[model samples]
Target: MTHFAPVEPDTATGESADLLTQVKKSLGAVPNMTKGMANSPTLLKSFLALSGAVGSGTLPAAVRERLAISTAQLNGCEYCLSAHTMIGANVAKIDGEELDGARRGESSDAHIAAVLQLSNTIAENAGDVDEADIETALEAGVTEEEIGEVVANLALNVMTNYFNVLARTENEFPVVSL
Candidate 1:
């Protein structure tokens, strides 16, 4: 293992404890990925900030979730798949077939489907997304900036997914669907 525990819970009296508390409070538990981030409080903070910045963007949450799952799928990141499955279901509140379809690598909605197609292509082709794919995503109510965000989300997840593999970050829960 990468010794992620030392950073997960620091024996400190100030900011580190507060950061852990903030993550725990927000998530009701600190996930191993975040714990790994806690390795460098700066990374934890930057990730949080990046997460917040990405979340605040105008991209539809559902499309973002779909795009995220699709990228995780391509990366073959079991940890990312496990992490994003919940966001797709619970946080995005997409249900049933839509949720299952996502894991099954299906796009649940028209716009999301389009985004998923593009994301999958990007993942499959090693980030060399076709020009026509970009055109289709644009026609699907996804702005150019949103497309950039999609790419960013994919890149960000790849980093975490690989980290989880190296760190063997503890899986906090077992959801069979993941």
Candidate 2:
């Protein structure tokens, strides 16, 4: 059961309605997570803005999706895990094996695997990653800009993961278990 019911787009008025409309227009469909977030227009807008900024960052789309998958799995957020699994496969064009690898912060590509490891370490340590973690990422060819974007993307995923879990946002995508 949803602790915070999603704000219905049709009945929503003012900022919530307008934001939901924008989400629907941009994404072609308003995800249930966004609908739940629509209850707080400020929160929704913040998420959108940060999401856009990170989307334009240096990290590749596939890498971002992988990071989201890994983080969602670590956080035990089924809603995010399921949603990103779909996006990772369909939109990011990631193969099944790679998507599964992401759940464990592993990748055949050493660079991507390194980034996933860094993200997991950061999430596990609450962003208090020591020098050795940074060194490992750098040694594995993770650039400074990429590191920054990893943190940003991790923050974004963490936010949505926590929100969906708290709101008990009903999963709309094909369910992917952790």
Candidate 3:
């Protein structure tokens, strides 16, 4: 069902399988998008590394999930939207209603709402977001450094979303209410 072949974990060989095993050990499963990324083992490894790096950064886990949720929404990536939705709820502990608002480009928290606005704008416009967008986030306490990190995070999700699209990656997680 994917535009590209998915490297099944049980059937994978060599380093691809190795990464799949690592994924399973870490997440209990190798997600479809990740499997699709295994089409290029290097890409799979780099993606995992970068994803982990950004996730382990100064950004709060909740905030990181929110930003990812917003970018997935902007890109209309059903795969990531579904996967991150559950993670956002179960792990990040963000409210269901609040998460739904992010899909609609809105949020109740001023700081998070500002971030959603900026991230969505960047994803939608390919980083051509105007000064006003940057100004709004800055006014909401997002620093210049944080803004850089936010942009990097958004870039990362873009890769996942497109890979999912190409892979037609099957949903491995339950879709929580947005």
Candidate 4:
């Protein structure tokens, strides 16, 4: 059961209401995670800002979505896993096998594999990854810009994962096996 009930968009107020409206307009639906976040305007705003920035970053949408899937899997956030599975399939066009590979932080593409490895390292080490870790991703053709974006995306997904765990947010998106 959800510990924190999602704030209904119609009942929200102030910045929460405005943010919900924006989410609805942009995504065509208010995800339960966003609605749960609406209970805290600060979290809602921060999530929206960071998510928007990362979504506009240099990383391809597929890569970003894959990173998100890997992050969610590492954190064991069912809400995020379910939501991103749908988003990855529908919005990013990631195939089933690729999505499963992403959850394991694996990819057939060598460069992307390096990115997944780096992302898993960052999450596992709480961003305390060592020089060798950086070297591996760099040697695999991960540019400084891409690394920056990867870190930012990792941070963003980590925040969402933690929130979902804390809120026990109801999974609105179609569920996917983790």
Question: Which segments of candidate 4 are over 4 A away from where they belong?
Answer: none
RMSD of each: 2.7, 0.7, 1.9, 1.0
Better of 1 and 2 by lDDT: 2
Best by TM-score: 2
lDDT of 2 by residue, 61-159 (tens): 999999999999999999999999999999999999999999999999999999999999999998899999999999999999999999899889999
Using lDDT as the measure, what is the rank order of every candidate, best first? 2, 4, 3, 1
Model 4: per-residue Cα lDDT at residue 86: 87
Better of 1 and 3 by lDDT: 3
Q: Write the per-residue lDDT of candidate 3 for residues 25-81, one digit (tens) a residue.
A: 988877777888877999898888888888777778888787877877777688788
Which residue pairs show collisions in model 1?
none
Residue 53 of candidate 2: its Cα lDDT? 93
Clashes counted in candidate 4 amount to 0
Candidate of highest lDDT? 2
> If candidate 2 were superposed on the true structure by all CA atoms, what would the RMSD be?
0.7
Q: After superposition, how far is residue 161 of candidate 3 from its true place, in Å?
A: 0.6
| lDDT at position 162, candidate 4 | 95
Over the stretch 50-116, how does candidate 1's per-residue lDDT look in tens digits?
A: 6767778777777667666666666666677777777777778877577566655576477777767
Collision pairs in model 2: none
Candidates 2 and 3, the one with greater TM-score: 2
Q: Rank the candidates by TM-score, best first.
A: 2, 4, 3, 1
Candidate 3 TM-score, true structure as reference? 0.91
Where does candidate 3 have its weakest 10-residue lDDT segment? 169-178
